[model samples]
Target: MTKVLLVEDDATIRVAVVRALGQRGHAVATAPDALTGLQLAVSERPEIVLLDLGLPDLDGREALRMLRAVSAVPVIVVTAAGAESDMVRALDAGADDYIVKPFGADQLDARIRAVLRRLGSETAAGPIVVGGLVVDARARQASVDGRRLELTPREFDLLHYLAQRPDQVVSKADLLTHVWQIPYARADKTVDVHLSWLRRKLGETALEPRYLHTVRRVGVRLSAPEALGTSPEQGTAA
Candidate 1:
């Protein structure tokens, strides 16, 4: 689930949005004023924040400025203000999205999702290279040495995420959360199945692995072949 911090002073709107977003699978946290919201933003480390333009303690824009100064968390302004200037100002001040009031849950949900997707794409930390494998996230392209690999969309996503942290063991649960955007309720078998296909395309297997290696009940790791201590023939079967 995505951690969402909602900063809205109005009790009715806050309750409605919190309830609706909770039903939609987002872990929602709320504050009725700017100061409390800012405090939560810094302490809780939410994935995204839904901010309001009008607040009791501090103006929403000022709060947004303070947030931008401290963190790069995606922010979507949800307010009654519909002025183009207000929208432009917020966007200029690093707001990922702007939404006017009197909107439905579906609309708000869509906006929130769009912002999070954009944020994910923007913060890839650049292309990842592991030995001969090259995954260019910005271009959504992967290659082995000079040969470009034609990967399925899921394969590419999985590879790109793994490549970002080369040599590090990433658990299936974390993969489900980051790659599948599934915070919970998904079997680890999904990751294994995809990894099997990915391994085949990379000319590897569970017994003799090159790039993607399974570490028993722990997780998987993407690393250079030489950096691994295990022999080429040594690895898990399941």
Candidate 2:
């Protein structure tokens, strides 16, 4: 039985989920606010966390960052926000996946199982290194040289995907389909926005590209700074 921590403010929804998960043979715990949820996360050491953004105290996103800073626990955001932007924000804020409000208990069960399966598989990937960058897939951590880079979960996944195929241009559609497991939609600026944030953390920009390079209408490629013949002073629009 997996120990799942459910963090939600609404007593009705919280009680329903907790009872349902318990009936499903899960060792479940509950918290009504973000601070209590975060506290339980550290103390309980659950296999996964289900977090609600509409907390009475701390914001769910802020709590997510705080949780990520100290633990590699898988988090699946359970929120009322249904917009794609909100989903992206949650993923970028370190949520492993998200379940919008009013979801079925079965759907939540499936999502939780999927996350655990993926996390289980990741343990065998070992670590990937290119130049100064090192990606530990199992730990969900990345570092540049000896300095650790605080990457969002989605950012780390994106970078790890590109690092697996250095110098190969991966299109935005591929990113949407693969990295995010979502259909490619027009007017969706998720990939670009994430790339921009990722670029800033890497200490470079699109114009003065070093690691991540845009292929104009194609996609982006990740490589070593020296391999791309880029100086540390390069700058470009992300």
Candidate 3:
């Protein structure tokens, strides 16, 4: 059974969700607030997290930031806030998916399954090559021209995301939400900062492009010199 951490303060909602998920053959663990949820997340390492935006001890966003700092566990924000901005923010904050309140158990189950599927696909064995860089996703290790690139957890996540979809334009908004686990509106120069660090380590720059390229007003793309022969949108990151 898939293990899940359900972080919700509302007892009624929490019980309902837990029951529903349990009926679907999932092993559900409950936490009433952010602190307990964080502790459980680190200790239990659930396959996925169902996070409510409001908690008595901590704001959901703050808790999200803390969680992302330590884990890459898939998170789905279950919130009362249904505004487009709210959804965007939750995505930017690193939530794998966002489900507004009053959602049916079926919808929740589908979302949970989708997140699990995505995570499973990511962990599947494959040799990922972008430009001259080769990543063994199963090992979570990357090398450029046979020289291994030592990357921090976050940097590795960022690089892995880019490498997974080489030559595809990924907006900073998407990166901030999906990669950094920050809400999109909260996304800022942090993406740029990390990109700068990545570029420096890669021995390339936005000005003197090599592996990474900025698509004016669009986003960034990773590609190699040989891959540059195709359309700009089709370049692979080295």
* Candidate number with greatest TM-score: 2
Candidate 2 Cα deviation (angstroms), residue 5: 0.3
- Among all windows of 10 consecutive residues in model 3, the one with the lowest summed lDDT is 229-238
lDDT of 1 by residue, 47-112 (tens): 999999899998888888788767767788898998756765665465767789899999999988
- Per-residue lDDT of candidate 3, residues 1-238 (tens digit): 9999999999999899989999999999999999999999999999999999989999897898789878878899999998866765666566778888999999999989987886688878587887788876556578888888866545667778888888788888898767755554554676777787777777776667677777766788877757775344433222
Instruction: Estimate every model's Cα lDDT from 0 to 1.
Output: 0.80, 0.84, 0.80
Model 1 residue 174 CA deviation in Å: 35
The candidate with the higher TM-score, 1 or 3, is 3
User: What is candidate 3's TM-score against the reference?
Assistant: 0.72
Cα lDDT tens digits, model 2, 111-160, are 99999998777657788888898889888888887888888778888888
TM-score per prediction, in order, is 0.54, 0.84, 0.72
> lDDT of candidate 3 vs native?
0.80
Off by over 4 Å in 3: 132-161, 167-203, 214-220, 226-238
